[model samples]
Target: MDRAVQRTDHDAIASKLSAVKRGYYEDEYLELFCPRFEPRLPLINIGTWCRVRAIDQAITEFLEKNTEGKTQVISLGAGSDTRPFHLLPKHPNLVYYEIDFPTQVRKKAAIVRRHLSQKVELCDSATPVTLEGDINTSRYHLLGQDLRQLSLPDLDESVPTLIISECCLCYLAPESSHLVLEYFASRVAHLSIVLYEPIGLDDEFGRVMAENLMMRGLCLPTFQKFSTLDSQTSRLRELGLTHTISAKDMEQYYNDLPSAEQKRIHRLEFLDEVEEMNLLLRHYCVVFAGK
Candidate 1:
């Protein structure tokens, strides 16, 4: 299958799973919206949510520190996400630009419209009930452009900008990934990126996740591994992102869990027994920074 031609059904399912849970995206319509996208494994849902929570926290911190009051945000591959509604309440001065395929953008807009209408009934925040509605008017400017033939649009130099691509780099060919990061680093003054990837304990687990994705009729150009963190850091340095945070820093969040939960986490059967590295850390996420 062509890498860019993502099966809509599969993509929708992934989006649902990705968004739902506090500290996560909390989108409750996944099962109702796309039932055919079944997660064969049970823990997949919670595991994915935990990973997303980590990503959200990482990006939230970066943006809070790096973004100026008038900064703009570019969210690449933004799925059925509620970030505009969630993040904008606190940072009203910041402008957000969301980019995704036409279908996702349209569906998300409709949902935002419906939700905004019901916000008064559902939410307690004094933040205007129609804020989502107002933001929906300009929060997401749909861009149907593909990444391979991508270029930055013209914007003011004084406006500090941040580019985000959550769980997108894995789908990119290695060369394209490098070029895209370089492109973002060159265009933005202070930049930080959070890339949530499916990793393996070693090459073996990496291959397993790749195969699992392939079985779903998807292609993974690269499945990053925890062991390669050093190489990734070095590569980002060359790309002009001077700061980096490896998955190791976030390990504390998971490691500090209740003893029983940690035990359950360790027993996750997703790994290849032969892999020498710790399976949990082997396949996870990392944050990159460029100043």
Candidate 2:
């Protein structure tokens, strides 16, 4: 299961790469993380775009609102995501952290050192570095730690932080996923966690999606556990993020965007399967919380 989860990272990067190549969004540093590439299905590209769009919206909102002091963005189970690179330079006071399995972290570290070593200015702060524990750069710490047993000594509760789980925590056992959220909510005073996961597992669309994933050795333990947008937000509330919470499915997300922006994305892809796109979008939702 661990290995299967790791392979999803590759699929994620490939999907992103395909979208970028198709001009869905602009990312100067994204191609550095993708080693393998192939034209993916339009459904896959559409799903990838929704995932990035929702998470990016949550992140931009968090940083814009918390502009007073040093802020941090932590990506849980971050795999080949180039967000830190894109965000760090734009927000000078921002510190970005990526946590994943040890093997994944090591792989990412090598890529960072080889391709982007000189591109990003390393953080000069003394707050410990987490690049496989061998490097010390607070600006971008790449920690290789399992979310099931995550431990961080440098997290400052006083500073506002955003945690992102883009189709990440869904892979864990439902109880473990709750524990991971509880661990952070208990430690961080001002926090918001954004989650993107498939819901409505009792529906036929979900059952077929589950079967398709199962054939590829991928499974979402939380699909049935937190089966709806309400349940996703409820998990955040149960974990103590009771202040502000919101949930939106991807179709709603796209509709909520500026009309011009929505049209821009629509023009990028000739999605003939409009019904399929709508069906897929309804099954996945973004559940966010602020505290």
* Candidate achieving the largest lDDT: 2
Local distance difference test, each candidate: 0.55, 0.84
Candidate 1, poorest ten consecutive residues by summed lDDT: 131-140
- lDDT of model number 1: 0.55
Scored by TM-score, the top model is 2
Candidate 2 stretches with Cα past 4 Å from truth are: 123-135
TM-score of each: 0.70, 0.94
- The positional error of residue 264 in candidate 2, measured at the CA in angstroms, is 1.5
Error of 1 at 274 (Å): 16
